[model samples]
Target: MVIEGWGVNENIEMVDRVAHCANKLQGWGKRKRVKFKEDI
Candidate 1:
């Protein structure tokens, strides 16, 4: 389910926003991995 706008500028903005979310997800995954290792 992707919600995109109609326009070049809007598309760029959406991409940037999505990229930011992706970065956060990557960071969160790394943190979780470290915690899992510590638990083991």
Candidate 2:
């Protein structure tokens, strides 16, 4: 989720929202790559 909100949620809830999303995507991508390699 590309979080681009401003207010109590974005300003106070989390600091590095985009970084967090990127990290999660990286992890998910890594898992998918591993699965694809295994399948091949």
lDDT of 1 by residue, 1-40 (tens): 1232223345467677687667767777899999999999
Q: Which residue pairs collide, candidate 2?
A: none
Please give each candidate's TM-score. 0.69, 0.62
Which runs in model 1 stand beyond 4 Å of their true positions? Answer: 1-12
* Strongest candidate by TM-score: 1
Off by over 4 Å in 2: 1-15
lDDT of each: 0.64, 0.64
Count of residue pairs whose backbone atoms collide, per candidate:
0, 0
What's the true lDDT of residue 32 in model 1?
Answer: 94
Looking at candidate 2, the ten consecutive residues that score lowest on lDDT are 1-10
